[model samples]
Target: MAEEPLLMNFSLGNDAILVQPKFKGGRWRERRGLRKATGPTGVNTDSILERHSKRQKTGNSDGPTRSIDYQRRTGLRHGVISSLFSYNPKIQSVTDRAEQESTTLPSNAPLVDGIDTFTSLGLSPIIASHLLTKLDIKAPTAIQKTTISRLLSGDTDALIQAETGSGKTLAYLLPIVQRIVQISEQKSKNGNDTNYQIHRDSGLFAIILAPTRELSKQISVVLDSLLGCARWIVSGTVIGGEKRKSEKARLRKGLNILVATPGRLVDHLEHTEVLDVSNVRWLVLDEGDRLMELGFEDDIKKILDKLEQKKGKSGAISDLPSKRTTILCSATMKTNVHKLGEISLKDAIHIQAEADAQQLLQEPTTSTDPIFSAPAQLQQSYIVAPAKQRLVTLYAILKRSFSHKGSVMKAMIFFTCADSVNFHYEVFARKVGQQNTSQLSDSTPELPTQCHSSVLSSVNNPDIMLYKLYGNLTQQMRTATLKAFSRNPNPSILLCTDVASRGLDLPSMDLVIEYDPAFSAEEHLHRIGRTARAGRDGRAIVFLLPGPEELYIPTLKHGFKDKRVNGSLSEDILRKAFAPAIASQTRETWEDNATGWQLEIERWLQSDSKIADLARKAYVSHVRAYSTHVVPERHIFNVKELHLGHLAKAFALRDQPSNMGRGGKGDEGKQDTGKHKGRNRDRSRNPAASDIDNARNSAPDPKEAARQMRKALNAMNPASEFNIA
Candidate 1:
């Protein structure tokens, strides 16, 4: 067989040397008998005897050359595998045991005792201090500590699986920045007199692709902050929401680091020809599973193809530094992730972050199910309410949540659809919005007769500054809403759909409320992950009707069973809160009030009264608006049974689940049966005349019923009293 050409990387010692296949044009000459010393910046050739002399001083006394011919024969494509790791037979296992074992270690456990500090990981002075001082990042996270060494070596590819909010963003970013800094320092050492600078027209050195635009922008923001002192390392974002022209201009001006969504990046590749990733040394796919899922496959493939073609063309140039190192990160490993790895990555070292040691020994199998394990610091709970009373319950809960404590709370409220988001936003803004707006005449303002209008005149506790974020909003509006909510220090509630779920980082977020149950467990996990980030404590409450409470919630809990290897329990924080709240007369009052409101609402729908007609029309209009997102007249009460298994896995409950059999599905029928049995037993024992007398006495008076109905209505909406006119 013809010998492979040597593309040596000397940092791994004398036994290690990277091999590149012979080019078609034979531009790369083979030195069969020669030995040479090479650095990351460039290679320097030496005669055999001179190489021996240099090796002797370095204490790497001339060792036998280990053949890495497997790289050429193994059918590996664009991504390059390092020879240093190839020699280890155990690590060569496709289902890597060591990697899995490493993930099972306690999250706080140091990978290596001495190298726990940032500087110890070889980060430059500027970057290290920034992490410690500006970001207040004291030590590397579990994933970071385990993956940083291989990444900084510039030869290893990594597949990292860590929990959401485990600081995966910084894990990859730190190493990439360190490598760039290392290269610049090496350039200065190699007689380059120019200052460390990134050229606008020059090809990109790093590209990080994320699944969502929010994540893309977030990564860009983090990059900007990390490179705060290193101003010369230019970065930019290319995502769907922004203008194509602006992105093209930014690319035309050149960037050292590009954080982008796959689709938009491919658009520039196909249309503009402005981006040059030929020199990209690091490629990161954030949320790798989602990136390769249904919508993203083609665009991701095109981007990878473009990179491969660029690298292949550049391969003939012997002076090129190294092949791009690909890092694929996902919160949960789905079946397609493995396929994506095989297609896009080389022989990569896998790193899984887990809290259980037993999980490390088992081989990972790909599945459609999501892995569910939330941080222990996160407190999970739920509120059980009827469909009609949900809004009433929500208002009560919000009022209590805000008033119960003196501290300000930042909450992210999630719903199922955009229309739901819009309707809720309108209701809450009209009803619960603070009466702090410039008062009419700043004195005795004329109170509107309508209950909804009259409520604006009442000044009490600061009302929640409600903000809406959904798919229907324009890009500008969406960005503005997020910015305003994130920046505001006052108590605020951000009503959104899944658009806020995946990767947006909201600072100081104290709570997450799932106003609508998520479609799956994974969605729930990601939604809750919006809070309790980076070792901070946060609370998450999901609202479910009895039907969902029995069927879906338990299924959600079961989803976490396998993933929670450490044997932690999912303690429902709401048990205490629920007990106290249920004990209050307010609970009974609200239920009665809700029933009356529903009856009134229905009656108003058919009535000719002007006040009733206005409310009925408003309610119908809202429902119609919501229907555009899906089937018309579909009530939010109905929770679908789709993807239950997948959602169960993502739910990540640590508690023993309740029995979900006959009593679990629905209980209203069973209760009704018992009620009839009791009535029959009573009738059998009583005489006919006595039974009749008892029935007459038991029946409520029409006058009393009417009085109760009026009282309930007045309690629900104080403005209804004035609307009577």
Candidate 2:
């Protein structure tokens, strides 16, 4: 049989060659011919040089002699082959083994040397010490462990997806700071021979973009803490609430790192000339999903365009490297986040940390199904009550939660609108103050105060303190509110709208109460993400209404279950919480029952009026906010219940009973005396029905008894009628 010619192809620089081997008798002959040669533009010179740089450096005399000998043997120029084949075969094999050992291990994969510390990831000794001693961060979190090495050792962009409070901030910040430190040390070693001209006022090396001002300020605070005692590393925050002149001054002072909101950063880039980020090596978009949800896409694109232009212009003028490594961190990987990554990042390493850490190098595809999973450590439950009783339920829950002595439980309560937040704060402040008043004088006793206003404005009582945060508040007021909640050293509650939900790094938050559910499941995730962070235990209680609102719990539960997560609220928890809250009656004042039938009629009227007032305030605020584009149109709603109902469906709450119209009145919830009397009459015929009726009627009728007592008191004193109104 004739020997089949074997054809093998190999690469030679930018060209490809095919070798045809022929066997004749007992010997073999080979013929080599160039198949194709690519043009210089088609050649990946950077990759070629990168591979060449990995070669082991040999003795200078032996290196050149070997390269010359190889060039002469191959009939190639010394210059061409010298750059490609600098290392000997033995050294090349060792380098290849080292490169293979450095690859990322899977989540379940064992470590290379079982060394899993900050120092092992190439962080500077000072930073590692600070993390261990000052910050008390002894070990890297799942996200940090997976990403730090990739971020610091190479030019790999990263998309980090860890649960909220899983140390994502530190994951990116540590490596970024380390890279900056390494570069700084190199520049210092080079002294006057440094290729880049870095100045005190133009030392911007990193930019972190947060979705909101609060988040931006939070990142700045965390960075400040981490960079503690690293005096050479200076970080600055540029948000909208701050003074432009002051921020410009800070920019002039030269910031090694900048944390900013997208719009404000874009404003500075357009208006300020002193600010320069041409050589920014790291661009981190924290809470990337929230940034896209807040409609910062254009602003983000604009900033990126400016950065690209700046890099291009600077590259033309200077020999300094201007490549940027982008880090996108989000709790959920939404489509918009993936789109943002594609637009901003190049060859990113995706590190997702839900159940495990999986490294993906290609573009990630976001699932069409909604993701609604809370942290595993978070204990989620809901209380079903009427909309009119929301405040009372909240008051009761707070009263129960903070009843412990010397307990320092900080809670963040989210409302649907600014009006709801303000109204609840005012009512809570007044009611708690009234309850705390001295009966002997009918006035508040002199007490230590932290707020400016004395009319229920300051609540420094040890039982509980009150603070409000909303978009309407001035920047100063918001700052004071956050500070009070953060540093008051007492049990406190922060009544806020969605403004607090995104990226505020509230520490030691014992609970998060959704006074009303978020406008969507996404917002709900961010809202509850405030707690159960960084491996800390926390709880969240959602106040759901009885009818359609009660359905939201199971819907949200199923969404998480679909993701194979244990985000379900235990039935026992819900049943227990809802039992007390549902059975509890609304507080009816003594004066509300002055006249026999007159008081009863007036009480109903007052209840309706209060509900109307709440609805009106919510509607007005919604219109104004959405009309002026203060908030997104989707966020516009008439009341908390309406908002809750709307959001529930977004989270996959299907088959929701539509019988309850905009009125949303639940079965006309009126207690009928004749109906109870009739049920008592049929007690013998239907024992089960009678038993249920008896249980329902067993709860004390505070309103009816108060009416009878007030009627008797009214007959004694006609002047009490004047006091009623």
Candidate 3:
């Protein structure tokens, strides 16, 4: 056999020394001869040996040169194999045990055999048939059953408190719609004239106020569907994002039901002359706690005052009640909610679903505080992950869920801010081989007409769809995005902020991942409430950082008042997250591939300036938002204890922590005053280059980003003081 040559390279200061090894008998031996070290072309090499001799004297030698080659070739493989197999074995064992022992609290209000159906609860036969045939609502939920009869009586104002997704919307809506229909029928019958019929000009009988435009639109949709059985009645929505002219036109035509957001409703009450409230009989504040949390107390107070001043002085309209009935619905009875009830409700009956039938019909009282709880059927859990592993762990969970053919078809991942949502959506969309739609023309035919412009599907896996929703999106886009997400039949994921947390009922939401914890425990309840809706079996998992964040587990448990809420350190989920790489033949290969995946993300961020800027903004905004946790929970989410570098890794950033400026506020102000003018000139001179310039200039100031975070936090906890500095 021919002799094999082995070469080894060593560095001494800036010089490179090459050595050859020879095998004598069966063992390897280093050659006695040494060639002079070479310096960077035409540099001196005499000092290399002197430095090596000094290292040998100091006993700081580089070990045997012959063994160096052998170790270099095999050391990495051994280390990686060992590490991969032993990754958090103790934690894995505990997680496995917990997984086996996991259990949920018995449903508080179990389904009763003799519960009243929609028809039995005083709904007309026509409405009941429409609900069953069109809406597929087979039965009234617990809250619906308890509150429908009370609302139908219209004897007093109502305060409906129930777990999220327990049919609070319908609890108030069904009664109002039924009353409107009943009044119209009675008027026609009493007058004994066909012209006595009620139409759109009959005046608005019900006003539904929601916190967000999306929720307002959703409420309008449900109201529209319920109105199908009585086409004579009309419904309309006036939210922040749509045209005021269109809303004015709708108001001019008259509507029996008006669903609106508080701000926009207040605007119309002050400006639009056609929006008459004199005949309004039913007022609903859906997601009442959320309305207060969003700082709508003033707007709501204005609305109530205006309605009272303009309320009809005449007697009952046909069979309808004389006084206006106000219904306030909320999942949590926080101090603000209680205060809101005091303001809007009068002689109100408090209704809640309870295990004890006797206690379910109690009147409103201020002495006893109500404990907020999630749905009993919801399977809630948490994962304690390091800051660096957050992104990968999320990826693992999504991958595992999507890998199954039909297990999880729809999922939601909630983030802290719009930037975070945008950042993650782009990262995952690009990873799945989809192009950035923002770079394309507005009229791109590649996107389906039914889908939003921001919605993207994986080229490799057509079944996987990604959607993004946040406050920054135009109202039309937000509405379109939500419509597409709710109707999508394939596996889809929505990355969103807290805007989607209240009163919006998304169908078949199998999973919810709280990538960022809510500002308060109540908010957390609302976030998880997105799943496990209407007695459906659903799952929710929240990610907590390894340190103080882990303490949040108990807080959540206490909030839910359920001992079954547990923290998991599941290796199986982590394995599944990295399954694409783990499918390889060897552990070493898979480990490398897994590591390479993260590196690939980091490289991608570096390649695109716009994406890199977004990642930094997301990281900073997340940290700022983390600081805005409610005062009681601040101990668990202490921002100073966070590892900025490690957190940056989750955003696929490779920069040092110190390099991440506080939102580039100083830099933004230092730019020339005519920078925008220069950009406009460039736009007219070269449109394509100006597009890139515009994108570069669009990165927001860090101070402004932090201010927005503080604003949102302030809205959630208006009493708390926030100092972002």
Candidate 4:
């Protein structure tokens, strides 16, 4: 019998882990200076010491020390000591527990604690006072509870899981300020030590990575305000589809902290060599998982790789490291995400919130809930409509969502595709009175508006609040829209593509509507997360048509579920999709089918004047306005619906053995053990399977599960033999 192998932290001093010789026993000594060797089986103290220096104490001047400040109670004099990583309350995985009901409100519904309060969270009284009086914080959210402690205590990493709007921003923000304040105070205390330039003028200590331009701009603004008030340091932003010269100028000075999007940031890094990542003491990957899906995975890798390279040799981490902390915050985390978490964080501290906190979320509280508390905010609900009627439904949702919020409209509608994004902009502007002809005629001709405040939506009595943003927005328009969205008192509605889905840093969003449900289960989790952010009780409404129900499930990931969540909706969940004709008649609209039809016919007429001459201009307008990319671009005809057989042949994922973790020749994914067969049962529950399972006898698979009986029948019964189909 042997104990299971455990994952251990590597001593930063050297690559070779210190192992003691065992004299025919299982025990090994944990002492210093055992021996020195060379080659494949050798140890080098000087090299180890050099390597270890990267992760040395922030202010340590010595090569080695006997004890680590377990509580991190000593000198962090080299820089700001944020209380974020430390003093984090130890709680359970209560937040992502999931709903008990058969249906969910939104795919990313708060699974666990939507935390509130800091009464006993161990934050210093001075910082707590600042939070209460200066920042107006009442409580902590799930993310805040986990991350704040790690940041404050100066630990390696904090991998946090909770829903959006759980006060994750302040979870990191407050501690960053606190650490800076502490560091500044320390330098003041040691005024006489001007002999060395080791810890000279501060360079950028933090780099925050966001998935979207809007989110990056928003977070940058928030950070500016926090830092501005304290006069801590200067910061700048690098985002896509925006003014390049201006952003480049900002980067030229080299900010004390930088907030950026993956794509644009890559461009900035490529062009600006002196941006100084080597001085980056902290890195924040906001909406990190979304970066992977945005076709930015390569870019993110390139950036991190470059940054790692900047760390001088062995690895970027090998340069001036001191238990470097990596924080991964997201609405939902699945099993595959664990690898991503591992890649981002080092020696991570996994923190999960309780489910009840998420279910019980409403308003901020003053006690017990130290993480954060969102205000009982936006009005949330769903509308029943067919996929064909998606646009009409969107217009209806936007009109009502913003209209009800009053004259000032601040809303962002999400779409799944580029065409959908374009269509909505046109139709909603003209038909819905959100915008119209006059405005469109003058809309910069080539792109959207640049003078954001004056860029009124062209419609009947255009409201003070209205805008459109996506990947295609000209750099100027995108930048202006973001600036306006953040400052304008009037509520504005900005149509969004998947580009904005990952991070919730979009400012003052009281409402979010997913025009089209997410493509994958992961998408659904991140989509509705836009609202209810940073201690604000926001509302998120997901529009689910009937055809998609089978694909929908409650909490398909490690956390999240279709159980009872506070303020959850059950009305919009359309059951039993209608037959073709019935569904078309009831759910479809003129803009959808008519515009789509026109678009297809026109595509065929392209390059032929006679064919084009036959089609009416009105039809073309409708076609361009309503038809989706698949219809207008002829993509639908090109892409054939794939079946299981086709998938088995094309992807061939099924060729691999089921339920195995085998790796390569020597050390495959397999753990080299057969004891844990039932460790992970993948519950790939879908509608078709549910339908078939319902048709089944409610018994386990005969071949797999020895039991032939249904529910009440036990596996122990041998006489319960059943016939196969």
Clashing pairs in 1: 103-354, 200-253, 200-254, 451-719, 521-647, 559-648, 559-649, 560-652, 570-654, 570-655
Q: For each candidate in the order shown, give its overall lDDT on alpha carbons.
A: 0.54, 0.55, 0.66, 0.45
- Model 4 is weakest, by summed lDDT over 10 consecutive residues, at 716-725
Number of backbone collisions per candidate, in order? 10, 1, 2, 72
In model 3, where is the ten-residue run with the lowest total lDDT? 23-32
Best by TM-score: 3
Give stretches of model 1 more than 4 Å off.
1-116, 196-201, 312-321, 354-359, 362-372, 405-408, 431-463, 558-725
lDDT of 3 by residue, 414-442 (tens): 99776688678777776433556345332
> Could you list the CA RMSD of all candidates, in the order they appear?
36.3, 37.6, 11.4, 32.2
Q: Of the candidates numbered 1 and 2, which has the greater TM-score value?
A: 1
Candidate 2: worst 10 consecutive residues by lDDT? 91-100
Candidate 2 residue lDDT tens string, 272-336: 99888777778999988877655566778898888887774443323234477888988776677
* Angstrom error at residue 517, model 3: 1.2
* Clashing pairs for predicted structure model 2, backbone only: 165-534
Give lDDT tens digits, candidate 4, residues 1-725: 99989988855656456554322100112112213322344332344333434543334444344122211221111111111112222321222222232222332223233123453555656666656666665556555665676667665677665566565666677776666556555655566453321231355667788766667777886787666445646778876545678776777765667887766677767877656676566677776555543334456667777777765432232223353456776555544355457667777775555433554365333322222111233234444333333433344344434434353345677765443454445434433334333245323534343222222333532454555665544445566666666566666776766666665456677667766554454565566556655544455566543322322333222123322333221112211111124543333322223223222322333433332222222122222222222122222212232122211111111122222222111123243235323221110111222222222323335322212212212111111111000
